[model samples]
Target: MSTDQFTFTVSKTDGTARTGEIRMPRGVIRTPAFMPVGTAGTVKAMYPDQVKALGADVVLGNTYHLMLRPGAERVAQLGGLHQFMNWPYPILTDSGGFQVMSLAALRKIDETGVTFQSHIDGSTHVMTPERSIEIQGLLGSDIQMQLDECVKLPCSDDVAEKAMRLSLRWAERCKVAFGDQPGKAMFGIVQGGAVEALRIESAIQLAALDLKGYAIGGLAVGEPQDVMLRMIETVEPHLPKTKPRYLMGVGTPDDIVEAVRRGVDMFDCVMPTRAGRHGQVFTRHGRLNMRNARHAEDTRPLDAESKCAASNAYSRAYLHHLVRSNEILGMMLLTWNNLAYYQELMAGLRKAISEGRLADHIAEVKEGWAKGERDGVVEPIDDKAIAAED
Candidate 1:
């Protein structure tokens, strides 16, 4: 892919935080962007229009899920993932590599590819690097990820080295299969488990391939937060500065902030949306559990100042009632609110980076979340009440 074909313009860089834009044929994705996961072609309870209304620039599709469910050929027959899903915005599709290793049963790894039984219905499937790229191309993805081997964290150094080497081989195959397209781009994944030397080796090998973008995969897979951050720090400097860097399947609000501080430009995770379905709501003041009894009598909105009606117009008591009663509307509303919150946070980070105040902005966010509040109003607990109980 030519540099002019898909452009990532860095408007400003404050420390490791950056504000930029990735212009593709489908649409423009703002940098430091958070892509809502639309695994299996939908964003769970929310519709595509509703997701766009929540201010998402782009959404992600899982290759393994789509390939197994409706099949890639079917999606192409139905007019690609964008039209099939009714989302006209840009979509990035993952290579089925992760699912082949993680979701499948009776897995066997070899140089040719991975062979495994489908978790759904116990069927069989084989996924190669070329096949993964072919599927993403069939889906007409704006951005496609390379098929790479992902080793579990806390593995032996020898195992980590072997996986990293295999991933490099797969990256080459994916790039060759992807060929050349004007707007479409393929991103290589950097996989080296927790070993810093292996991470550097993987980055150097993938950078030599000259792909459009690079993703730091194989982290946040149950590793401690500090170890993941250290791995990122080790690989960040090796990646090409002109191209975008993505961190796959990464984390909470604090994790996102920390990733930005370490020079990561893109992220995808199911945390907010998936967590919301189970009664967890993310706010400026940390995560709040709507299933808790404290919210049963609380009549305040989740966030009074939010522009999202789902968050600002509903009372905690009503939300709790819905969740407690197992109403489907509860999941819908919470998913919308959580997605809106994620987008709002990303917008703030972009603005802060462009203005050269990201460090201060991050500190302020940490402090605000540390001092948790309800409905944006802090309630002081009486110290005398505790003394009286004693």
Candidate 2:
């Protein structure tokens, strides 16, 4: 687990979905990995140990959030994010370009980077590609993303192409700023709106750099599911199969499944944690909103067959009570259940790919979601039967 080098090994492939491992100095990440967003150096409500225990090999840190709050230099003096957050695993740091658009106010973009007033305190700051890379390095990020402009949907072709070309140029600057590290990596983000030609052009240009990995950014912002999937398809053919392909800030269970089917190897999203805080948790029966009065008298666990205790041990009624009362335990348990569900989904996808039954697995997974929950006390699936399915 300890090394001064980074490498990716693919074990199996079923259509476009892959079962693989990303070996780094810190640890090995199992692919198609789901990284819980630990923005501002934490995964919000959950503890570090709990996040790792949910099968997360890595977690994401937000450069803009950390830089604005505790300040990046302070974190460096305090021993970097992993040591600061007590997560001794691989940490992928976003370049903050997305936030330079979403979180900052009065933003202005030029070749030098983004100049904007801080959303938190209205302080002025500039986040150039080099500066963004420097900030991530100061945080000692294991995997760093390059700075890129992400335009909202419905923008003109000229606007999209302009942003895409600028991002390609910045990707070069990031490479120079990142320099080299024995066990670290820098990934490029592709941006081109909804245009297939622009997506292919951006992908080809980024691939020419032959960076450690590549991410299809600028989707899931407002586009429909089919649009997002189409973009993935457009770019996948031009990307390097040997390296990892990531889809940033992407989505629901069905979203993840569909993206994986199109060859995306990594993902990071706030949906599970954010939804949990809102009294919602994912299950085989689809999303359950604990605030519903129908659960007030329900005694059955959210998913008695779930491997996570949060989902299998506590009754829906108790969860509903906690959520209704605004209890911290409600957030913690729901977040735990949601993360467990995501990890379970990833595990199933990996197994299906390895077993050459990805189609069957996908059909079963979708069917389970559509069938909804069973009535009364649900019987847990036996470990042996589960193994047989695998």
Candidate 3:
């Protein structure tokens, strides 16, 4: 466990599924890892210690947001993102390419880079691959992504090919800009929309650069789950087996399970935290709407078996009241619960993969979700309490 250099070791594999460790100087990331999105230096409503306690080995920092606000230079001056955010574990950073592309109307892309108006202040900025790498460096990212154009799916093959080629070019620039970093990595992103040939070609080309790792981008961005899986299948075959594979911006629990089955090693998404803020919570029994009236009189905890306090200690009735009343604590509790569940799922995946029973584990997990919440007797609301409130 001496991790002075960046390394990825697959400890076990079940068919295409894998269990592994990505050893960085800062810490070790368990493969099939789900990095909670900590965009703008925070994972929304949870504390850094809580995020770590929930079993996340790494958290994702948003290059676009961090570079725009607080500024990369400022973060570096403030002793990098780990010190700035107080999360000392591994921090992976996106290249800011997706956020730039998301600003479709406000941005223009060229061979050089993306020139766009900032969403925060409408100020103009340009992001080249080299600058993206530079920004990630300033943030002290352990795992940094290459700047690549991620086109929305269902586009023409011609458009897909164009973007894929452009991304390949950008990948080269990012690699060169990243230079030599002992315990850090700059991952190349595979982008080809839904075109199989383009995806294969992109993967093959990026694998040639032989970056520290690879990420499958341009997926889960409005594409059907089947299509996304198809893209993963196509790209996974062409990429180097020894390197880690990350599927970016993916997804629900089902999506993670499917992608892991197809050989993805790392993942990041905003679904869990975002869903929590909206009064939704994901559990072993699937997603539940805490805002629903059905939970108004339920005394049952979200999951009594869960090690998460929010899930085991709080009653559905109380959670329902908090969410309905729009209390901030409800958002924090639900967010914590969701992240805990996701990490638990990841731990399960690693164990199942090691045991050579990933398929069985996935089936059981899906079954629990399909079975939904168990039926429970509702506790009667006290009439005197209700009368007093009225």
Candidate 4:
């Protein structure tokens, strides 16, 4: 039966790590899930159908971009983001807080909310907590985030505490604006920049709201990998276990795996797609620069053992040539391959946690990356050996 009220159920656990499903009227989202960034309703270089088939339960939309170009009301009139984009599944939309903060010199922050000049043009706009919720509602976002202040890392203790307090205040306003949406969810973002006390306080206070979910933000801005992981560790305990925990804008495959181990249930990032467009390929054998000279004469497929057609059908030499020539098809193929690999990794993590061997699975996955490539050739993984190890 389809659930009318948003709900999450944890089915398995390995240490602090967990595997679960978030059930809503539209669909079920598997965790530890990775949401691809579909900034302006479209995932760059890929079709919606392809995105669904690649194992993504949800794709993220940016409120700032959409509101600027197409406008939120326009999307609603056209039948919301799902009907407009041809994606029938759940969609999560950011509150535009991160993008607003990124505007730096172009924006001014105060108690009323952020006032910023649009990058698309010189027009000025104000995005209070209420306005952000209204935009998400207009776009029919299944999962919505509260507007929060996201400060860059290496900030002072005073700065982090101030941002955290403001975000907590905003969370309250966003909650009131998001009242009684049974079929949807409002997630409060925990922002403390890199401070342990501030992160804990943010998580505890947000969890007190008893919202549908929580997200750990403010870490991936410029901090070290260790610092990011530590923040996750610090915040995880304070968040409620029943609700989902999201690590916002998290990074590399290694970062995802480690964060999952630390108990994050959801994630979103532009790493795979962004890296793909730049001729970078992520694989079970680690990252490969397709534009490298070594691939120019190689004839092997990027990953002959994989199921994605782009990964299995194209030769390294052809891909290299396409990248070198700046072919559009090259970007398309590489983006497809990268998204496929990320989904594959998510599937592996789910399976590992279910079978109670996440620790070993993580070690093997890291070992695969450690074993990079031999003379520019990445040997195929043996499924039988992996199963036996499990």
Candidate 5:
């Protein structure tokens, strides 16, 4: 560990909104950070260097995917995930708890751990809180999440309470297993389904652990938007304001903005990249679908102001053709555009919070998206102009 040594220091605050940085051996991560999901060791279509250029301070990897495909031991043997994936920056790895429940089949959960068949090849595996820590350590992750049971939203009161309590016990075991890794930290996940009281209890218990950070888990798993916000509100006051707060698998540009206003610090979601693969791209004005027929003739960039070349250099008409033809560049460019938009949004939130104008900033962002439309017709790109640029 460096002098920073796995710490979060708050620089400024705006109501529930605040700005800060998390210091790790890998680097310093700006608060209100949006971490792109690098499932199975890559961030889908975008390369690691491109993801870095997009201003991301960190990225997330799934233990379930890596352990299933390449195996954690193999990754460790190959000089850890950073060398293996060519990403030298910080990486946060999930504990394999959530994916096991959601993706795996024939799952059996007990006090010790969960045993399930892999979704990929139907291979058998067991993931306990200790083993989850071991796998993350093998991957050399900077931030490691505890293996907590994530009950789906809308579970009965009895079931929610049961899972929440179980997760608390598992958190303790994960803490012990994580055991004093310098420059690295273990984060306890708060899981309580949609129950406000249960969410509070979970947060209270995890905060007492003096963990390096905390995460709001078991949400965005089919709950309504307001319900998820309510859960955050219920848990925020109970968590220590000093530790970094992560909202796991929760998302969208709007969701990130609202969650920042509610005191959450970090976020990881598949929405941006996943949407990109399907021809959807996000912009300051609004979202765009390249697969639409009207875009066949329109000639405009996704956003002229965006620093990313993909957003400013390529025209919508070109993107439309690529997506329509199922070209690989379509996925790459859109994924690039979407991730750039998310990182841009996070930067805006940080700046607004530091300036004590987060509320006004949030309103402005939403209004821009609400009042505009990307549907107006425009003349096609001139062949001569396109050829000259190329």
Candidate 6:
């Protein structure tokens, strides 16, 4: 596992949807992978072991939260993020630029860096490209993102252009500060709001740096789903085909499918875990809300067809009870179920792409979601039946 030898290999391609593998020192992440967010060094209510058991190839760590809470220096002192979190798998750390701009107050942006108060305790901190790189390095991230300004959606062209240009300049600084390493890779993020021309400029400029990977940032903030998908299409063709394309902080199940169709290979979002805590569970037959009174006395699992034991073994009635009673296990079980659904979706996608049946598979998924579950029914599909179908 030579660090310098990190690579992505496309095994199959159907249209723009591809089934590939990203080889890293810790493990090989399957392309079109949905990385569960592990902000603050935990995937909220989940042990790292359980996360891995859900077939997660990699997990994302937040530089902003980690730096604010445990401090990057403290993590490094304890033997890097992998050891600090007790997860011996690949970890990708964001630059903290997005969080600082979006989550912090009184943010002052300058050519040098961004100054803002920590959302946690209102302490002041400045993050430069160099500092962002340094923090990620200390965290020992396998994939480190470049620090880039994330502009709010619906900004004027002039404002968007300035931020895009500044982000490109910062990308250069990030590259210089990132230096070089064997197994570790630094990625450059393209920021241009919603303008195609600025997006092209950002993509072309970042492409010139030739980072290990490229990520499209700043669109998912408040833009419409179609707008985000269109922006991705605008930038995808200009990016190097050999390097992986990542869409930052993106999306729902439908959003993921659309982005992959446009050639994105990686994604990270807090939707699954966050929504899980709030009683939303992703299933083959659309989203299920455990808080609904309809689920009371239901003996069926969240998804009888799910490969995950948690999804198939636990009754909806029990889960609903746990959630209504504010039991911690409710959050845990539902989070696991949601992640399992995501992984299952990814697997279906990969299989579809490989077999040149992505369109049909996607149609089936949409149809299943539309059909949903029968009300007041606990018709759990047996594991044997699901296995036979597969």
Candidate 5 wrong stretches, greater than 4 Å: 1-4, 373-390
What does candidate 5 score on TM? 0.95
Write down the lDDT that model 4 would get. Answer: 0.90
lDDT for model 6 comes to: 0.87
Error of 5 at 89 (Å): 0.9
Which whole-number lDDT from 0 to 100 does residue 320 have in model 6? 95
List model 3 lDDT by residue over 156-273, tens digit each. Answer: 9999999999999999999999999999999999988898998899999999898989999998777789999988988888989899999998888989999999999999998888
lDDT tens digits by residue: candidate 6, 1-390 = 424467888899889778898897888888889999998888988889988988898999988888888999999999999999998989999999888987887789999999999887899999999999999988989999999999899999999999999999999999999887767789999988899999999999999998999999997777889899889989988999898989998778989988888889999888888877877788887777788888899899988888898799999999999999999999899999988899888888888888998889899988787677543232332323322220
lDDT of 3 at 92: 96
Alpha-carbon TM-score of each model against the true structure: 0.94, 0.95, 0.95, 0.95, 0.95, 0.94
Deviation from native of the Cα of residue 117 in model 6, angstroms? 0.9
lDDT of 4 by residue, 194-244 (tens): 889999999999999999999999988878899999999999999999999
Per-residue lDDT over 128-230 for candidate 1, one digit per residue giving the tens place of the 0 to 100 score: 9898988898888899999888877889999998889999999999999999988878999998889899999999999999999999999877789999999
Q: Each model's C-alpha lDDT?
A: 0.87, 0.90, 0.90, 0.90, 0.90, 0.87
lDDT of 5 by residue, 1-390 (tens): 334489899999999878999998888899999999998899999989899988998999989989998999999999999999999989999998988988897899999999999988898999999999999999999999999898887899999999999999999999999999888999999988888888999999999999999999998887889999999999999999999999998787888999999999999988888878878888888877788888888788989999999999999999999999999999999999999999999999999999999999999998888765534422232223322220
Over 223-321, each residue of candidate 2 has an lDDT whose tens digit, in order, gives 889999999999999999999999999878999999999999999988888878778888987778888888899999989899899999999999999
Of the two candidates 1 and 5, the one with more favorable TM-score, higher being better, is 5
Better of 1 and 2 by lDDT: 2
* Model 6 spans with C-alpha error above 4 angstroms: 1-4, 373-390
